[model samples]
Target: MGNTTEVTFFILAAYGDHGQIKYLYFSCLLLLYITICLANIILISLIYVDRSLHEPMYVFLCSLFMNELHGSTTFFSVLLLHILADTHEIAIAYCNVQSFFLHAYGTTEMYNLAVMAYDRYLSICHPLHYSSRMNSCKMYSLIVFTWSFAFFKFVIPMSLRLQLPLCGNIIDKLYCANYALVRLSCQNISLNNILGVFSLVLSVAVPLIPILFSYVNIVRICYKSPKEAQVKALNTCTPQVISLLYFSVSGFFEMVETQFDLTYVPQLIRNVCMVYLFACPQILNPVMYGVRLTKIRNAFKKRFFPNSTE
Candidate 1:
């Protein structure tokens, strides 16, 4: 980051081409991508087609699944291409686009989870006013707010990164990351550093406050309620709490990979860690919800296998 160089394109040196092994990696990623697509698509279909799922919470879930599909495609498609290609170069403009969407993908997911927690809180803590409070208008507003706010929050970082003069053109990972690009800057990056911390608060940490508050209230209410009520709360909240924790762990891996020194670790392990940051959530969320949530499972059956008795 000392010498100035105007980098037009970036080489993704992290992609290891071990000849035949590339094919194996390609196949595995292809299979994983297909699974991610199918699982999320099925979840989205069930939510949209089943009138019983027209509620605000399910609608939020549909949005979350749609975002999963978008994120998976953005990641897997380019990765599959690079795995098969002879060169691992990405044009600067395209890299910027990918960086923006990928970052936005992560931030949007946290926001979606935050809103889902609020919906769950409203459902468990104030059932009598849930309908009025989480009306169609307000629900849609929250959904829109999540997406818009995420994209808006990430734009500042992307814009700051664009103005930087890169001292290097090689990204150490399979994908272009905003912070990685910032690390390549030849100039003083104190502003980017300051903004990075500020954006982390706005994009990641701030949303968690509300989500935690919502869950705490739910827990307090369930503690004082009947045994059946506690069971109902767990039944409704289990998938989301698991999803939130899963994503948090994945995000932690990402934060460590970017912020810490991982050069000593084997490349395969690092790559696996990076892949888990996004892929695990996409695959696990839908599968967990599909299998564990009776309403979703029954609705899926009623929609696809009508011969089965409900």
Candidate 2:
């Protein structure tokens, strides 16, 4: 083999079996991908088309659903292709592309949730100032920052990997990840590890702190407010809290799997966990918002069933 530059492809070692079980796996994943796309698209359309739903909260929800769709497509599309084909190899350049988008999606999503938490905090804790504080300019600024911050976080690590000669090209996972790719580098990866940790904090902890803080203030305010105010705040805040918990738990599992060896876990169980970690959030997020948020539900019903009273 020529110097590390000659390597052109990588073997993804975590593909499902080549036997009969592959079809069952393929069928399940295909259904999941379709549902995720349809659900997110419908939500985005509803928000865009309905003038009444065009507020800060719904705008944020639309962006959140779009991010979910982007992330899911990056993972599930590549995965479905490999499942259908006999070979599970990916070109180096495209692998980097996938890593970039998936990482960005994860970070952006966390930031979106944090922004939602902030919005909720203002609406409930400081209703008098909510309208002025969350103007169009501020909303655009938050959305832009979430995308830009997440984009650059992965770019540095990816550029670093590109310069270093890879020692091997075998990635033992379903999809490409910055950490996984860096692990295959031939040179010392201290810098990469440091930056990876930095990215993790930026992606997960940065958004998480705001969510926790906002909720803390919200809880305090609700406690001191009247019974009616308490009920209203609780209904409004429940969806965001649920979304936060779901993402947190799933992100935790992903971190553990990446940092530690899980060889002892049964292969089937591990596979299920891996698939669910990514798929569940994309599928459930829209459902959580759609069913729980009365404004969205009533709007959806009205738009789809204009004539029916029930």
Candidate 3:
């Protein structure tokens, strides 16, 4: 039995113990990380330099890339450190910081996705008024609100965690999450659990409702248009929708997993989900928008190799 005053650290099981497998895993993750960084940076740069790419849709894409960059940065960089060190032990203060930033970025990404959905909603459902409604002031406000809400959602939980006395520090996950922190508490975790559930509902579920409804309505509207127009519209959003669904559902599952006995499930499932959350969106977002948008592709080509034109 561990004493309340004793601080224990968690031992994260690496992806694989086999030397060859570990090497392969590290190599793969490194490549993926590099790809994510380069892709997002180029996309952001293209949006910034090209005046023609300046539209509501591309603006939202820029925001999405920014959010994804930050979100993946928060999680994956820490993950890289863990992979190199071959340990997951974090000091209590560091853990708190990690939790704060992790939740902050995660929440920000969720809100950004909601913004994207709203942009799509306006574009497809109310095309005539999209420009008028989602104007410069409104866009600025939306960006501000997304960041503010993310900060709001994270502040209390982070503060509460700071106040709580940690009896043990055996966090199972690679990074600090609500479940991992709550489990470390020597006091009643009921309040923490309540807040956790509430945040998940608000941050994940609430926005998702509108996003799903928006997409459904978008599909309906698209069906009324010509096939090419419908395909184009669907192409614009399909990646975002896929990303939203994967991240939201996987995130919810990870949250729920914390409530159950960790021993019951295979750690592999958790690891796979964690990797999926980080890897999928970062890999797909650029392709979804950059490849599909001719303007962005041409801009990228022009920017990278100023002499390339066929």
Q: Write the per-residue lDDT of candidate 3 for residues 1-310, one digit (tens) a residue.
A: 2356555454454343445566666788888888998889888888988898888778778877887787778778777777656555666666667677778777777878888888898988898998899998998888888878887887887677667776766667767776677777788877887888788787878887778888888999998999998988887788778778777776767666667766666777777777777777777878777777767878888878889875
Per-residue error (Å), model 1, residue 107: 0.7
Report the C-alpha displacement of residue 256, candidate 2, in angstroms: 1.5
Off by over 4 Å in 1: none
Please give the clash total of every predicted structure, in order: 0, 0, 0
Give the C-alpha miss distance for residue 160 in model 1, angstroms: 1.5
Error of 1 at 274 (Å): 0.9
Q: Between 1 and 3, whose TM-score is larger?
A: 1
Query: Candidate 2 lDDT, tens digit per residue, 1-310?
Result: 2245456988888885678778887998999999999999999999999999989999999989999998999998788888877888999888988989988988998999999999999999889999999999999899889888889878887888778777688887888877888777777889888988888888888888999999999999999999999998998889888888888887787788778888787766766777776788889989988998899989999999888786
Q: After superposition, how far is residue 206 of candidate 2 from its true place, in Å?
A: 1.5
Model 3 alpha-carbon miss at residue 198, Å = 1.3
- lDDT for each candidate structure: 0.89, 0.87, 0.76
lDDT of 3: 0.76
Q: Which stretches of candidate 3 lie over 4 Å from their true place?
A: 6-21, 305-310
The alpha-carbon RMSD values of the candidates against the true structure, listed in the order shown, are 1.1, 1.9, 2.5
Ranking by lDDT: 1, 2, 3
Instruction: Flag the better candidate by TM-score, 1 or 2.
Output: 1
